[model samples]
Target: MPVGEEVREAWRADLDPKIQAVRRLARRYGARLLAADGMFAALSATARPEHWSADGVHLTPAGHAALAAAWLRLVA
Candidate 1:
């Protein structure tokens, strides 16, 4: 499930810039940056509302599992 409109707005306005800054810093420091946004987007494309919490800002159990799977793939 894609994020709610309001959440998407907030992400674009607030979180996205912060995430980008973090990525830039990681690059500057020659540190590994695990970019999870794409993974989350992919999951959201396939997931249901139940995958997220009621507030739609947090992950539910299934969402966490999906994220873990993505993280494992990145690490492996």
Candidate 2:
């Protein structure tokens, strides 16, 4: 089942700050941050809805592949 908008919003409110903190710390430490959230957001904006799972919290197979590709681009 799909998650409710309220739950989704709550999760974002809780997690977004932590993600930003990690990104900031990674930059401070001269470490590479994968920017997975950004990648996912971009994909969600441009790609078809099938990339995400029914619950909207997890990724489907294509989404995982896309994330892997993004990671490869950052690492390679």
lDDT agreement with native, every candidate: 0.72, 0.80
Please name the candidate that would achieve the greatest TM-score relative to the true structure.
Answer: 2
Q: How accurate is candidate 1 locally (lDDT)?
A: 0.72
What's the number of clashes in each of the models? 1, 0
Residue-level lDDT of model 2, residues 1-76, one tens digit each, is 7677798799899999999899999999999889877777777788655455556667888877887888899899
lDDT at position 19, candidate 1: 88
Which portions of model 1 show Cα errors greater than 4 Å? 1-4, 49-54
In model 2, which residue pairs have backbone atoms overlapping below 3 Å? none
**TM-score of candidate 2 against the unseen true structure:** 0.84
What would the TM-scores of all predictions be? 0.69, 0.84
